[model samples]
Each structure stands twice: as C-alpha cells, then as structure tokens.
Target: MRHTWRWFGPVDRVSVQDAAQAGALGIVSALHHIPTGDVWPVEEIAKRQAEIAAGGLHWDVVESIPVSESIKTQTGAWREHVANWQETLRRLSAVGIKTVCYNFMPVLDWTRTDLRWTARHGAKAMRFDRIDFVAFDIHLLERPAAPADYDPETRDRALQRFRAMSDERKLSLSRNVGAGLPGSADGYSLPQLRAHLETYAGIDRDRLKRHLFDFLSEVTPVAEEVGINICAHPDDPPWALLGLPRVLSTADDYADMLAAVDRPANGMTFCTGSLGALAANDLPAMVRQFGPRIHFVHLRNVRREEDRTPCSFYEDEHLEGDTDMVAVIAGLVAEEKRRKTEGRPDHQIPMRPDHGQEILDDLTRGAQPGYPAIGRLKGLAELRGIERALSHLTYGLS
Candidate 1:
C-alpha cells in the first residue's frame, strides 16, 4: 500500500511539511475552497498540486468533490450538478489525478455527535453517542417523524438526555452534527436541516439506493472515458441517522452498487473505521471481496461498547480496537499482489491512518478532531511494521 495523509489544503492545521515529515508518499485532498456543484477549473487544480509538490508529496487522490444533496434526491438543479460533476472529472483527469473518493450520504457527511469525547485512556477521541443523536433528532432539530424510527425505550432515553442539556449544550450538539466537516458541502442551520430532510420524506432505503444507481448511470461512463475511478466511500458509522436512509453501509451494499453500475470507474473507498464499526461486517473477508474495485483506504479503528448497535463508539488506538488490524492489512497486501498478477496499473492502493486519538502533545497542538499528528504518525508506524513483517515472512508483498 502507498501511505497517504488527508490534508485540508493551505488552511489545514496539519501542514504539507507535516505530511512530508510523517513519511507520507502521497497526499489526499480536495479543492474545498470551491463551492459544491461548481466545476473545478484546471487553474485551481494546478495550484493545489503545486502546493503538494512543494512538500515532495504528490496529490494522489481527491478525497472528495462532494455530491450535492440536490443530486441525491433528484431535486433542484440536478442536471446542472451532474454536468458540473462530469466536467470536474474531466478537469481533474486532465491534471493527471485519476482516483476520486466521494460519498453519497445525505444531509451530514460522516456524522459525529461528539468531537472531543474523552476515552478510558485519558485521551480524547471522536465519538458518535447514540442518545445524543437521538436527542438532536427528536428534541433539537425535531425531525417530523424522527421519534417513530426509535423504539419506546430509546425514545424515552433520548428525551431525558435532551431535557438534561442546557441551551448552550443543545446548540453545541446541533453545531457538532450540522456544521460541515472537511468535505461536507454546507453547514446546515436547524431550520434548513429540518426543511432539507423533508425532501426525503418518502425516499426510503430502496428509493435512496435507486437514486445512487441513477447517479452512477449519469457519471460513470464519463469517469471511465476520462481514466478516473469514482470510489464511493461507505456511510460513516454505517447506519441510519436523523431518520435518513443509508444504502452503502455494508458488504452487500458494495456488491449491489458494483452490480448495478457494472463499470470499471465505479468503485469503493473501503474505509475500515466506517465498515468495522458495525459488528456484522467481517473486515478481512470484505476487504478481499471488494479488493479489486477498491481505489482508496481509510485505516482507523473504533471501540464499540457492549451494546454497540443504535450507535455508541469512540475512536480507539489503531491496533488496539475491535478490528484485527494485522489480519486486515494482510488481506489488503494479498489483494495488491493479486492486482499485480492481473497486470492492473493501480496495483498499489493508497491508504491513510484516519481519525487518530488526541493524545500526548496533540491536545496542546490544537489539531483537528481525530487527526492529531502524533497519533496518526503512531498508527502509520504500526501499520507499516505489520506490512513489513508480512512481506518478509510470506513474500506476498514487497
């Protein structure tokens, strides 16, 4: 695997020089300055590329160019958005950047209820507190039919949790969930979020998924012709949130997506943290199964509580979480060898140790949530050690 780091371009707290010092062979980023649904002109792409090149790192993958909500529901300006998306692909491909990682999750991109939840180890980690989310859904944003999605006991618990919150705390919860993350298109206000979600009132899992397939139908051919791979990142937390439907949450979702599109450009990002959060997803098996079409990887681990479902998890140390990091890496290594044997140009896939815990001097550094420089450096070192040991013992990877 070619090690990479996620950089939020010029304004990122983690600098390009920091990525260089971390020994990342490639940098994963996007033109975040540009608004959603706008074409990424060649000039802007070249500028960002030059910045990365200055740090001796090449921009390997576009972490995203966010799929707009309008396109997801086939609502306003959908055709124009698709046209701009295709044109962005053409522009990106022209600049020699072929692999693009994107996600179709509506409303919030990778929802998290808490950004600084303290772990048992005294370090801080990003957490998705189930009750907090439910509280926000039912009590804060007050989604029309949100309470119906949860059972009586869960709903009661969420109500109690919401009641406990002061005005400031409630607003903080709303901001945490709605304020746009790195690749999220817009930071939604409460009224705007409530109104936007209403659009999906009748669009359940089946219809949302159909919309995803329709999206691929419009853009995959252009991607294939342009030598670009559109890797759809799995839904973070791998489940429903705010009463929204999540289609790309499991292994079956990937198989269904690939079968529906049947195009080489349509692919998977294979984020372990997102998929591994769900107990049902067998990490190693899923890695092997989806290996051929996987264009990128996000390596991170989450510690799920005894009662993990309905969402309760915190970011854990890379090798110490529920996921078997060694076994997962071994599978990825084998898959790379398989790709090489098949004579594929993208045999060596790019990976990044995502969402590291806030520990050591990281707390003082004021790093972005779950992206402490020291923490990720520790994760990358551990993953590299495993890759080296496997390659040395089995000759399966070099």
Candidate 2:
C-alpha cells in the first residue's frame, strides 16, 4: 500500500509540497486544464510531470482522462474523441504514468447537496441529502418521471421543501446538483442539461453498458500496448439519479465490465466512499473480491442513513463510517503480497485518503472542498498507521 495524494495541478491551494509534507509518496492528478476529449500531448503531460517531480513526488496515476459525453453516447465526433483518448493513454504511459483513472458517470461526475455540511464535531464535511436532491430533481430540475423514482412520502417532502424554498435557495440547489467536474469547476444550465438529456432519449442500462463496452473495445488494446491500466471509477451515489443510468455502481456492474473485455488494461478504481454510499455494497468484501483488478484506491468514509435505499450521507473521518476500513486495508495488504509473490511490478497499489473534512486552520486555507490539507494529512496518517499495523501483523515486518 503506497500512499498517494490527489493534487489538482500547481494552482491548487493545497500544493504538492503539502502532500509531501503529509507523507504521501506519489500524486494522483491530471491535466485538468485541458478540455474533455482533447488530446493530452506529450508536451503537456511532461509539463505536469516536471511540476510533481520538483515537489519530490512521483506522478503515479492520472485520476482521470475524462471519458467525454461524445464517447459515451456515440454521437458527434465520438470516434475522434476515442482516438484522442487512446493517444492520451499512450502519451501518459510513455511518460511513466501507467495507471489512468477515469469515470463513466453521466453529466455530473459526483453530486452533493452541500459541500460543507457541518459535522457533529464542528468540522465541515461534504454531504448529500436525499431530500435536498429529490427536491432539486422533481421541483427545480423537474426531470420527467422523477416522481416514479421515489416513494410518495419522499415526493411529498420534496414538494413541500421546494414550495417553501426561496429563489436563492432554489438556485443553490440547482447549481449543487448539476455541478459538473469539480476540478474544472464546470457545469451546465438546466435547459442546456435538458438538451444533453435528450441525446440519450432511447438509451437505458443495457444500452449504456454496450456503449461502455464499445468504448473499451476501442481503447483497451491501445492501453494494453501502452502498458496502461485503465481503472474505471465507480459511480458516486451508486444509483440512478434524475433518470440517468449508473452502470458502474455495483460489484455485478464491475463483473459485467470485466466480462465485456477481459484484459489487464481493463480494471477498476476501488473507491470506498462512493461504493459505501449504497447499503448493500459490502465494501470490505468487495475489497477481497476485486482485489486483484483494483489498480488504484480512494480511501474515505461516508455515514449513510439507515432507513432508506436512496439515503442521505456525509463524508466521515477515515475510520468512523460504516466501511470496515481496517479489513479493506488488510485485504489490500494481502493482495500486495500475492502480487509480489507473482513477480508483478506494481505490487504496491497507489492509494490516497480521499475526501476529508475541513478542520483546524484548513477552515481558512482556501483548499478545494474535500481536499483540505490538514484533514487529508490526518486521514493519511491514520491510514498509514493501519497499513503499518497490517503489514507488521501479516508478515512480522514493515
């Protein structure tokens, strides 16, 4: 288990120096400045490489080379976008960045009703309230068929919430739910998003799966040739939202993904917080099941509500939430042992303490919502301790 930190390029308030200070050996980042579906030329990749190297950190993985909407829908310039994506993989591999993390979540990369929901301990944590989201989808976005997705009680509460909300609160809800790629701070207006939705008029889960497989068919070979592991990030919330299909939400989904294309290049990013959002995901068990194929990992926790399927949740401290993080770490340690025994080069998986609370001076640090310097440093310290204990207990050595 190699410690890594997600660094959003040089402009990020939490600098590469901060990650190193926090004992992270590598950086999980991307050329987020480049637009989606664009070719990340070797020059651009190298420029980012130089930046990380200067901070005494390795550019271990690309957290995403975003799979554009065009590629997902097989529409306008999709073929071109696939080619560009393939080229990006080759370039990244050539620059010694072999693991590439990307996601298939439609429209929004991740949705949260509040970025700073106050924790009981007085720190600010990212949160997703089902009620707030339902209010947004059914009342504000008015997504067709939204009522059918929820129970009548939920809809009633949503309706009441919407009716009682002021115009400012409604706009806030819209922006929060429709919020796009956070790294890029990009998003779409309601009408614009509605038009985007129309592009998928006839598409459903099976169709989306086929499209994803088609995408893999085009790029996996290129990735294999380039020695890149294509780690697909699971869908956040791990459920359908606003009538959009979330194909990468469960273990079965990943099983199907692997069966679609059985290649080492086709793998997954084990994200505990996202998978833990759903009650039935069995995160620690998933860690054991998908152990070999998980190329990168995001270690974070979420406190999910108990009473409902689509429940409210807020990010928790690394070890506090429902996820059995110690067991997951032990699973990872065992996998690392197997890989080393098998003579695999990437025996130590690159992992980062994912989303964290904003505490201490981080309250004024101007850091990105979940990437607070002090908070992540704390989580990383805790995770590092877990790894050490597991490594020592399993092998009697670090």
Candidate 3:
C-alpha cells in the first residue's frame, strides 16, 4: 500500500512538510475553497498540485468534492451540479489524479459530539456519545419528529441529560454537533439546519438510494472514460443522524452500491473506523469480499462504549481499538499479492492514518480536531509496521 496523509491545504495548521516528516509518500487532499456546486477549474487543481509538489509529495487522492445537498435530494439545480461534478472528474484525470473520494451524507458530513474527550493516558480523542447526540437532536435542535426516532427509554434518558446540562455546556454541545468538520463547506445555524432538514421531507431511505444510483449512472461512465475511480466514503458513525437516511453503512450497502453501477470506476473507500463503529460489521471479512472494488483506504479504529446500536464510541489508538488491525492488513496484503499476480495496474492501494489522538504538544497546538501531527505519525508508524510484517510472512520478502 502507498502511505498517504490528508492535508487541508494552506489554511491547515499541519503543513505538508509535517506529512513528509511523518513518512507519508502521498497526500490525500481537496480544493476545499471551491464552493459546493461549482466546477474545480484546471488552474485551481494545477495550483494545488504545485503546492503539494513543492513539499516533495504528490497528491494521490482527492478526499472529496463535496456532494451538494441539491445533488443528494435531486432538486434545485441538481442536474447542473452533476454536470459540474463530471467536469471536476475530467479535470482531475487530466492532472493524473485518478482516485476521488466523496460522501453522500446529507446536511452534514462526519460528526462527533465531543471533540476532546480524555483517554486513559490523558490524550484527547474525538467521541460520539449517543445520549449527547440525542440530547442535541431532541432538546437543543428541537426537531419536531426527533422524539419519534427514539424509544421511550432513550427519550427519557436524553431529556434528563439535557436538563442536567448548564447553559454553557448546552451551547458547546450545539456548536459541536451543528458545525461542519475541517474540509466541509460551512457550519449551520439552528434555523438554517432546520430549513435544510425540511428539504428532505418525504425522501426516505429507498428514495435516497435511488438518487445515489442515478448519480452513479450519470457519472460512472465519465469516470470510466477518463480513467478515474470515483469512490464513495462510507457514512461516518455508520448510521442515520438527525432524521436523515444513511444508505451506505453496512457491507450490504457496499455490495448494493457496487452492483448499482457495476463498473470499475464506481468503487468504495474502505474506512475501518467508520465501518467498525457498528459492531455488526466484520472488518476483515468485508475487506476480503470487496477487495477488487476498494479504491482508497482510511486506516483508523474506534472503541464502542457499549455493544448496542446507537451507543457511544471514541477514536482509539490505531492498533488498540476493537478492530483487528493485523487481520485487516493481512487481508489487504493478500489482495495486493493477488493483484500483482493478475498484473492489475492499480495493484498497490493508497491508504492514510485516518484520525489520531491529541497527544504530546498536540493539545496546545490547536491543530484541526482529530488531525494532530505527532499522533498521526504514531499511527502511521504502527500501521506501516503491521503491513511490513504481513508482507514478509506472505511473500517471503523477495
């Protein structure tokens, strides 16, 4: 596998040089300054490429070209947005960047309720407490249909938790849940969020899935023609959030998605932390099953606070979480060997240490939440060690 690091461009506190020092050969990044529905001009892509090249690294993957809400709902200039997305793919291919990772999560991207939960060793990690999220949904956002989404027991627990929070805590919780992450476009105010949610009034899971398929139908051909792989990132938390439907959460979801387009250009971004959040997913098994369709990988792990659905989880060390990191890497190694034997062009996959704990000087640096430098360096070293051992055992270190 090719080691990559995610860099959020010039505005990011963690510079591209930091990624190089961390031992990453490739960078996973995006033109985040570009608005959601606009086309990424060739000039902009070239400029960003030049920036990464100046750091002695090449941009291996585009973390995302944000799928606009209009595209997700198939309303309000969605057709034009699809045209813009196709153009972006063509331009990216023209620049020799083939892998494009994107997500179809509506209204918000990857979410967390607590950004600085202290771990056992006093390192700060990102966490998603179900109760806290529920409190935010019901008591803070006060969505009309929110109560019906939870059972009586959960509803009561959330209400009690909300009532116990101080005013400052409540404000903090709202900001954490409502705001977008680093690469996302912009955060939403309460009324703005509510207005956006109203747009999906009757679009249930089945309808949303159809929209995704429709999108693939239109763009996958362009991707195939241009030699680009468009991979959909699995939904973070791997579940429904804020009354929205999450179609890409399970192994079956990936199976269905790949089957929808049935093309090499339409693929999956295998994210262990996101898929592993749901206890039901068998990580290694999914890797083996979808090996051929996996275009990009995000290597991270999460510790589920409980064994139930909708339970809380926090980002854990790269190798210390519930996921069997060794077994997962073993599967990836085996896949690479098979690809090599078959003489496939895309034999070595591109992967990155997904998110890391805030340790050492990370706490004071105010680096992007979940993207501290030293912490990710630690993760990359550990993951690289595992991959090396697996390769040695599998191929006898030729």
Candidate 4:
C-alpha cells in the first residue's frame, strides 16, 4: 500500500510536513477550494500537486471531487454538474493524478452520533449510537414517517431515550447527526438539514442508483480518455438513514454500477469499515471479486452494534474488528503481484488508516476522527509489518 494522508487543502490542521513525519509518501487530497459542481481548473490542480511534492510526497489520489445532489438525483442542473465533473477529471489527469475517490451516500458523507465515545481502554473513539440517531430523526429533526422506519421495539426504546434527554442533550444529538461528520462540507441546522433531506425524498434507492449510473455513464468515457480511474466509495454503514436511500452499499451495488458504465475506468475504493458494517459483506471475498477495479483503499475496522443498540459501534483496533484484515491484505497483495506480472501500470494502491481511536498522546486534544497522529501511526506500522511478512512468505522478497 502507498500510505497517504487526506489533506483538506492549506487550512487543514495537519500540514504536508506533518504527514511526512507520519511516514506517508503519498497525499490523498483534492482541490477543495472548488465547490461541488464547479470545474477544477488545471492551474489549481498543478498548484496543489506542487504543494504536496514540496513536502517530499506525491499527490497520489484525489480523495474526492464531491458529487452534487442534483447529479445524484438526475434533477436540476445534473447534466451541467456531470459535465463539470468530467472536466475536473480531465484536468486532474493532465496533472498526473490518476485515481479519484467519491461516494454516493446521500446528505451526510459518514454519520457518527457520538464524536467522542469512551472505550473500555479509556481512549476516545468516534461512534454511531442508534438511539441518538433515532432521537434526532424522530424528535429533533422530526422527519416524516420516521416512526415506520424502525420496528416496534426500536421505536419504543427511541421514545424512551428521547423523553429522558434534557433540552441541551436533545439539541446536541440533533446537531451531531445532522451536521456532517468529518471530511464533509459542514453541519447543518435543523431547518437547513431537513430541507436537504427533502431533496432525496423523491430520489429513492432505485432512482439514486439510476442517477449514479447516469453520472457514471457520462463520466467513465471521459475518464477512459484521460487515463483517470473513477472509484466510488461504499455507503457508510451500508444502511438507510432518515428514510433517505443508499445505493452503493453492497457487492451487488458495485456489480450493477460497473455494469452500467461497463468501463475499466469506472472503479471502486474498497473502504473496509464501510462495507464491513453490513455483517454479511465478506471483505476478503469482495477484494477477490472486485480486485481488478479497486484503485484505492481505506482500511479500518469497527465493532458491530451491541445488542443494546441497533446501530452502535466504535472503531476497533486494526486487527480486532469484524473485517478479516489479514485475508483482505493478502488478496490485495496477490492482485498487486498479478498486475505487475501482466505488465499493467502497477497502480500504487494508496491507503489511509481511517478513523483511528484517540490514544494516550492525543486523549485530551479533541483530535478529528481518524486524523490523530499517534493512533493511525500505530495502525500504519501494524499494517506495514503484516504486509512485509506476507510479501516475504508469498513472493520470497523477490
């Protein structure tokens, strides 16, 4: 794996020099200054690439050029937005950036009810608690038909939890869920968020999937022409939220997506934590099945919901969660070798340790999700050690 860090432009708390110290040789970043639906100028892309290279790292992948909701729904301005995205890809490829990662999760990118969940080890981990989400959807944001979204038992428990919350607790829960999580644009107020959710109300799962296909069908050919691979990220948690549908959450979703576009330029970013959230998604099997199309990766693990809550989980140690980390990495290594032997471009699959827990050094720092230095440094070290051992065992170190 070509270890990389997600840099949110110059304003990011973590600097390129800081990333260098973290032992990452690649920077997974974007021209975030250009808002969604705007074409990323080639000059701007060159400037960012120069900035990353100045720190002795290569701009390996564009973490995203966010897809606009209009494009996702094939509604107002969608054709224009799709054209802009194609232009962005063409510009990015001109600057030597080949891999671009984007997700189709409606409204929020990745939802976490608790920004800070205390672990048994006493470290802080980002979490998604179901009751908090339910309280937000039902009592706070007050989405229509939220009651029917949950089963009887869940609805009762959510009501009980909502009744017990003080005004402040209720407000905070609303903000936490409605406000976008880390790497998202920004959190929205109740009224603003509801308005956003309303946009997706008419765009159900099937419609969203069709929109995604249409967007891909338009962009993939441009990607192929420019030598850029567009990789779609899976839906975080692989479930519906606030009655808004999620389409890119499963293996079948990926199959349908690629088939729609039917181009190698259309690809995937195999985020283990996102897909692994679904208990049925076999991470290793997915790697084998989609290996050829996977151009980038995000490696992280999560403990599933406890019996106490329907959608509760905390970031687990790299080797500790539901995902079979070893087998997943091994499959990637096999693909790497196969690509090399076939005289392919040897796509340096850049990976970042997503959502690391706050550990000893940064316990009180209120570090952002998955961006703390200490925890992710440990994760990268562990993954690298495993990769080295596997490389020796599998290919005898050449």
Candidate 5:
C-alpha cells in the first residue's frame, strides 16, 4: 500500500507538509476550486501537483473527481457534465495521475447522525446510531413515505426517539447529514436541506443505479485510454435511507457494476469502513474478489450493531472491528505481488486511513473528529507498521 493523506488542497487547514510530516508518502487530493460538472483544466492539475510535490510528497490519487448530481440523475445538462468528467480524466491522465477515486452516493456523501458522539473511552468518534437517523427522517425532516421505508419495529422506535430529542439535537442531526463535501454542496440551511432530500424522491435506487452504470459506460472508456483506473466508492452506510435507495452498498451491487462495463478501468475504491458498516459484506473476502480491479483503499473499521445500524467504532487496534485488516491487507499484498510478477497495471495500490477518532489532546480542541491529527497519526503509524511486517513476513525480506 502507498500511504496517502486526503488533503482538500490550498485551503485545507492540514497542509501538505503536515501530511508529509505524519509519514504519508502521497497526497490524495483534488482541484476543489473547480465546480462539479466542469472540466478540470490541465493547468490547475499541474498547479496542485506542483504544490504537493513542493511539500516533498507525491499526489497519489484524486480523493474524488466529483460526479455532479446532474450526471448521477442523468438530468438536465447530464451529457455536458459527463463530457466534462471524461475531459477531466483525460487531463488528469495526461498529467500522470493514474488512479482516480469516485462515488455514486446521491445527494449527501458519507453521513453521520452525530459528528461528535462521545465514546466510552472519553474521546469523541463519529456515530450513526439508528434511532437518531430514524428520528430525523421521520419527525424532523419528515420525508414523505419515510414510515414505509422503515420496518414496523423501527417505525415505532423512530416515533419514540423523535419525541425524546430536543430541537438542538434535531438541528445537529440534520446539519451533520446535510453537510456536503468540500467542492460539493455548501452547508445548507434546514429548509434548503429539506428541499435537497426531496429532489431525490423521483430517482429511486434503480434509477440511480442505471445512472451510475451509464456514467461508467461513458467515462470509463476514456479512463481506459488515458491509463487511469476509475474506482467507484461505495455508499457510506450501505443501505436505504429516508426513502432513498443506495445502489452501491453490496457485493452484488459491485458485481452489477463490473458487468455493466467489462473494462478493467471500472474498479472499486475498496473502502472497508463503508463496506464493513454492513455485516453481510465480508470485507476481506471482497478485497480478494476485487483484487484485480481495486485502485484505491479507505482502510478503517466500524462497530456494527446487531440491529445493523453502524457507528464509527474506535479505530480498532489493527485487525479489529468488523473488518479483518490483517487478512484484507495480506490479500492485497498477495494481489500486488501477483501483479508485480505478472507485469499487470495497477500493481501498487494507494490506501489511506479513512476516519480516526478525536483522542489525546485533540479531544480538547474542536476539530473534525475524524481528521484529528493525533488520532490519524496513531492510525497511520499502526497501519504502516502492519504493512511493513506483512511485507517482510510474506516476501521473506527483512
């Protein structure tokens, strides 16, 4: 694994130098200034790459070349938006960026009901308690058909949970879910977020899935020609939400994707945190299954409750949580070694610590819990040590 850190670029508080100091050899970044559905200029790519390289780090993967809502829904200007995406891929490839990570998650990206859920350990971790999400969906946001979306038991529990939350709790839950990506939707007011959720009402899971397949059909060929591997990120929670269908949440979902376009360029990001949120997904097994096509990895784990709603579990001492980090990384190592021997493309995959808790001194300051310096530094150090030991053990090298 090529260790990397996700940097939001120029404006990000965590500087490239900071990432390098943290022992990351590569920077996973993007041109966050460029709006969705627009072509990323080569000059802009060069500028950011130069900035990253200046900090003594290489730009490994584009955290995302964001797919606009228009493209995802195949709505107005979708053709133009997709054209811009392909052009961006071509430009990125021209600049020697070979691996591009993207996602098909609609509206909101990865969501958390509580951005600052206090762990039993006295540190704050991101959480997605079921009752909290259900409360927001059924009472506060009040999505039409939300009741039908939940099971009879969950529906009953949702009403009870809604009654328990104060107005402030409701606001926080809504804001946490609606808080968009860096170059994506800006922070939304309550009313605005309500409208945003409503926008996806007509585009159900099937529609979204078709749109994603169409997207791959269009841009993947360009990616193939440009020597870039286009890896689609999985849906965060890997389930339906507030009447919205999440298509990329299962192994079958990814199988559907690979079948849609038989190109090697169409790949998976292999985010264990996202896939591990669902108990049914065998994270390590999936890594082995998709080894040839995995271009990037978001290696982290989650504690999956029996009821199936997940919370950001503490950054498990490696190989903990639902994901078997050792088995997964060991499989990845074997795949990489095979690639090296067989002379295949995408031999060295880029991976990053997906999310870490706010611990140690970081818990005192109010930084984003997952991006806390100390916690992530600890995680990176552990993962690096694991990779090193695995390499030595497997390849018979010191």
Candidate 6:
C-alpha cells in the first residue's frame, strides 16, 4: 500500500508539512477552490502539485472532484456538467494524476450530529446520534413525510428528544446536520434543504441508480482513453437520508455499478469507515471481492450503536472498531500481491488514515472537524504496524 494523507490545500490548518512529518509519502487532495462543474485548468493543477511537492510530498490521489447536483439528478446543466467532468479527468491525467475519487450522494455529503462527541478515553470524535438525526429530520426540518420513514416508536422517541432540547441545542443540531463537510460544496439552510428534497420527490432508489449508471456510461470511456481511474465513493453511512435515494450503499450496489459500466476505468473507492457504519457490510469479504476494482482506500473504523441499518455510529479508533482492521488489511495486502503476480501496474493501492479522534495536542489545534493531525498520525502508525506484521506472518516478508 502507498500511505498518503488528505490535505485540504493552503487554507487547511493541517499543512502539507504536517502530513510529511506524519510519515506520509503521498498527499491525497483536491482542487476544492475550483467550483463544481468547472474545468480544472492545468495551471491550477500544476500550482497545487507544486505546493505539495515543496513539502516533499507528491499529490498521489484526488480526494474528489465534486460531482455536481445537476449531474446527479440529470437536470438543468447536467449534460454540461458531465462534459466538464470528462475534461477535468483529461486535465488530471495530463498532469500525471490518474486516480480520481468522487461521490454521488445528493444534496449533502457525509454528515454527523456531533462534531465533538467526547469518547471514553477523553478524546473527541465525530458521531452520528441516530435519535438526534431523527429529531432534526422530523421536528426541526419538519419534512412532511419524515414521520413515514421511521417506525411509530422511533418517531415518538425523536419527538421526545426534540422536546427536551433547549433552543440553543436545537439550533446547533440543525447546523451540524444541515451543513456539509468543511470543504464540501453542498451546505444548505433549512429552506434550501427542503427545496432540494422537493426536487427529488419522484426519484426513488431505482431511478437515482439509473442516473448513476448513465453517468458512468458517459465518462468511463473518456477515463479509459485518458488512462485515468475514476472511483465512486460509497454513500456515507450507507443508507438513505433526508428522503433522498442512496444507490451505492451495499456490496451488491457496487457490483451493479461495475457491471453497468464494465470498464477498467470505472471503479470504487473502498471506504471502510463509510461502509462499516452499516453492520451488514463484511469489510474483509468486500475487499477480497472488489479488490481488482478498488482504486483507493480510506482505512478508518466506526462503532455502530446498534446491530442494524440506520443506527448511530461513532468514528472509533482504527484498530478497535467493529470491523476487523487486521483482516481487512490482510485482504488488501493479498490483493496487492495478486495484482503484482498479474503484472498490473496499479498493484500498490493508495490508502489514507481517514477521520481520526482528536487527542493529544490535536485537542487545541482545531484542525478540520475530523482531521486532527496527531490523531491521524497515531492511526497511520497503528495501521502501518498491522500491515507490517501481516506481511511478515502471511507472506514471509521480514
């Protein structure tokens, strides 16, 4: 595996130097300054590359080129957005950055109810409190159909939870749930969120999935021609949210996606944290099954509050979460060996320590919500130790 760190560019509190110091040889990043649906000029790409290079780290993978909402819904300007996305891939390939990661989650990206939920060990980790999310959905957002999405007991629980909150807590919950991730392009106010939901009124799971397949059909050929691998990130939490459809939540979803586009360039970003949130996803089995098609990896873990779908989960310590980190890493290592034996050039997968708990000086550093420097450094160290031990024991490497 090629160890990397995610850097949110110049404005990010966690600098590229910090990533290098954390022992990452490659940087996974994106041109977040570029607006969605715009072509990424080679000049901007070169500049960011130069910036990372100056810190002694090469930009190895793009965390994303945001998939525009227009494209996801196949609505206004969607055709133009697809063309622009192809152009961006071409530009990235021209600059020797061939692996690109993007997600098709509508309206909002990965979300959490609490950005600073305290852990038992006195560290701060991000959490998605299930009842809190339900309360926000039904009581705060007041989506008319929100009640129908939950059971009667759950709706009652959410209502009670909402009633117990103070005004300040209510407002905080609304902000945390509505606002997208720090660098995402899809933050929304309540009215805006409602309007967005209205737009998806008739587009259920099947229709949304067809749109994704259509998108892959349009871009995968361009990707193959340009020698770029476009990997779709699995839906965070791996389920529907805010009444919107989620097609890429399960292993079968990925299998369908790959089959629909049946191209080498069409692939998946194996995000353990996102997929692991759903207890049903067997992390190691999925890795072994999709190894050939997985182009990037986010090796984080989450502890599900319940043993079912739509339950709350907190980002847990990488090795301590429900997912067996050792087994997953071993599968990935085995996949890399298989690729090597098959003479594939992309044998070594690029992986980063996804969302670490805030600990040590990280508590004061105030880095991006889930991207504390020292915490991720610790995660990377632990992951590296696991990979080394697995290699030595399973493959006889010293």
CA-lDDT, candidates in order: 0.88, 0.89, 0.92, 0.81, 0.80, 0.91
Q: What is the C-alpha RMSD of each candidate to the true structure, in Å?
A: 1.6, 1.4, 1.3, 2.0, 2.3, 1.4
Error of 1 at 56 (Å): 1.7
The better candidate by TM-score, 3 or 5, is 3
Clash-forming residue pairs, model 1 = none
Best by lDDT: 3
When summed lDDT is taken over every stretch of 10 residues in candidate 4, the lowest stretch is 305-314
> Over the stretch 1-398, how does candidate 5's per-residue lDDT look in tens digits?
88998887776666788888889999889887788889998888999999999989998899788898888777789899999999998888887898999888777788778787787578777777787787787787777777777779878887888888888888788888777774444566668767767667689788888889889999999999989999989998888766667989989999999989989989999988888888788877897788888889888878775644443233443345778888788888888898888898668889998777778877775554467667677788888877888889555332
Provide the lDDT at 298 for model 3: 94
lDDT of 3 by residue, 14-78 (tens): 98999999999999999988999899989999999999999999999998988889999999999
Worst ten in a row by lDDT for model 6: 389-398
For candidate 4, lDDT tens digit of each residue in 356-388? 878987775555666776777778778887777
Candidate 6 residue pairs that clash: none
Q: Can you write out model 2's per-residue Cα lDDT over 124-167, one digit (the tens) per residue? A: 99999898899988877778888899899889998898889899
Residue 303 CA error for candidate 4 (Å)? Answer: 0.4
- Which is better, 2 or 5, measured by TM-score? 2
After superposition, the stretches of candidate 5 with alpha carbons farther than 4 Å from their true spots are: 182-185, 309-319, 364-366, 393-398
Candidate 6 lDDT tens digits, 1-398:
99999998888889999999998989999988788888888899999999999989999999898888888888999999999999998989988997999999988788899998999789999999999999999988999989999999988999899999999999888888887756665578889899988888788899999999999999999999999889999998789998888999999999999999998889999999999998888999999899999999999999998876799899999998799998899899899999999999999999999989999999998888899999999999999998888778556442
The alpha-carbon root-mean-square deviation between model 3 and the true structure, to one decimal in Å, is 1.3
What is residue 208's positional error in candidate 5, in angstroms? 2.0
What TM-score would every model get versus the actual structure? 0.96, 0.97, 0.98, 0.95, 0.93, 0.97
